[model samples]
Target: MSKPLRVGVAGLGVVGASLARLLQRQSEALASRTGRAIVVTAVSARDRARDRGLDLNGVAFFDDPRALAGSESIDVFVELMGGADGPAYDSVKAALNSGKPVVTANKALIAKHGLELARLAEEKGLAFAFESSVAGGVPIIKTLREGLAGNSIRRIYGILNGTCNYILSKMETDGLSFEECLKEAQRLGYAEADPTFDVGGFDTAHKLAILASLAFGTAIDAEAIHVEGIETITQDDLAAADELGFRIKLLGVAERTARGVEQRVHPTMVAKSTAIAQVMGVLNAVTIDADAVGELTLVGPGAGGDATASAVAADIVDIARGVAIQPFGRPAHMLEEVERIPMQRHEGGYYVRLMVVDRPGAMAAIATRMGERKISLESIMQKGGARLARRRTDPPPAEGAPETVRVVLITHATSEQAIREALDLALADGVVTQKPQVIRIERE
Candidate 1:
């Protein structure tokens, strides 16, 4: 009865179309639940003739999303358009500038321009929610903003990229190579034709930047966060992780450290017993550590139109119920520019796999390099093997390039700088045949 909570949607791609269908199909139930009928009055897409599998009869359509954003018929604008800039940014900005509540699933947009947008939304006294941006349906933003509002959030971390998770999960379970699993993921639509964005860790970085802002009350700094992709994760790494009773996952971690706010996205080896370690395939799991909550882990579908739309729809319902909250869990101005802690100061256990020229004193030299810096090794594994397939085009390994041995070391907690220096020394000393394959360990 409250004016039907009028809605406008931009970008009628898979997610937009799904959201349109969902609103129509669940109209009655949503009305009863929220005590306000939710209706899709305006929709925007590039193609007007293309069938969206929905009857848009009696609804307004706009070729340009910015026009729909400025329409007076809709009270709320939902943006599913992807990209860090361009139409998505312009449309959302227009909607917020006009004092309309905007809900968007654009992680890149939020990560890159969240501070400016949040400031504008606060100034206009309107809602600028992005629950669907990070970890899809996990409701992580809500948890940090509402559930843990009473406590000091110490850290937030999780497996944020489902594509990388699927690839890694397949590699671990099926004993398949990264290439094989990646191709299969592409066939299954879990990965894009150009899987660079997902596998390269930029996608995770975008999501992490948003979360870091919400959790730590810092300005979103996607560029400052250290990003490491999963492309370097080999089958041997997976096998080694399994042998050590651990699972490898690509995690985006943000924490309030002594130095400042530290955000990073990289391949992490979590112990088998951890809750996040069990999340496999396309599922995402996020853990928030706070003073009051201790550790709360949220697990669910990380992507897909339906799952993400569920989150978007929830924000709509909250708006209908007149719920108010900050876009980043605090006033945009109050979210100060916290100093960013560089990854060099990051302290953590590490899993290192080095190809050594199986000769005497090689192992001792590695040990000495670590010992010089007082870096303690938890365990050492030696697997006898032949020369790794050193590229088909390259000449044979110098006839007798010293039969290589695989030495895997699990180090106790140490600074990233110390480990890097030790590894560099080992490589320079010619004790290592190639660069070491290092995966940071996350016991929690």
Candidate 2:
């Protein structure tokens, strides 16, 4: 019998508890797979008296997660605690400084501080891995770092947040308002009570930062990426998108451009026939465009206890087998510094929805503004005002006069700043009722 590979886990929440149970139940299989008995020898969490439904037996317990990191009872420290700072950061730093391998699912910590930690781990010749940091159960990190190592990756993007995806999906299929869908998402545990981090696109941005580092061999730059939330997205946007032969998804897109690396998180209008558009509910899909692989997409459940735990367990198994890969594929020190492309300079097609008063020459005024910015229109349609039409509360359209007209326009590829300037000119001209809705269009 081989010696048992001791493991200590911090933060026994949903994914944390599931990982412990998985290691216990699949002990024999894991041992057979790795030629070593993987055992949970110690654990740490907030509530010691709280029942996690797992038999602790003789496993040691620690109140402070940082203490558990350097304990003599464990070989590798597993970090399930989230957040960019505080206990999670302190404990992870402790474990790495003590020369122990670390397997974490902390995307925020990785995006914000991954380069520093990776350097520390490499300095000490210890493995530092975070396979579960992005896209839950998908082997996206491995795919980008190793599987596609032979190829030069051109771009990588995806529906990375399950909560946002679920909300958007519900809004599309059931034709519900954004607020209504958000409430249901919270009730179902798909979203937090305070869902700003997920819905606001920061969650996906964190994941994208990590992915961008691996895919582009650059230092992690989470803050540099452009971010836009889906909070402004409405059922009317979906209906208009359906009519335009497109599906709206909140996407985190990263690509190597002529200027530099471009990273953005925003609601994207993908064609209805595309694979990413077809993915619905809480599921996720990542599309990678590389020279050798062409375009490869991996789709699966992006979140959940068992699915995420499985990813954590896979990292532990690799460590147990004495397999060590670079934290970001290439040596962290060798990662290049690339210019961060500004969102305002991004060129893409756009979907614009505005409610303008049905006054003579209103259409001409809108078209003139767009033309001044060199924006070309792919298509334009005017429809009856929405039921909840009056977003700006514009005094019920003045009784006897023509009702407010809803206009939807699809623009050809143009810079974001140009569109904003054109829209600003139109809005300032007093043609639009309130703010206009804008959604970027993604061809693939």
**Top of the candidates by TM-score:** 1
Candidate number of the best lDDT: 2
Kindly list the per-residue Cα lDDT of model 1 for residues 295-352, writing each as its tens digit.
Answer: 9899999899899988999999988888768899889999878676789999999999
Clash list (residue pairs), candidate 1: none
Clashes of each: 0, 0
Candidate 1 Cα lDDT to native:
0.90
- On the 0 to 100 scale, the lDDT of residue 311 in model 2 is 93
lDDT of each prediction vs. the true structure?
A: 0.90, 0.91
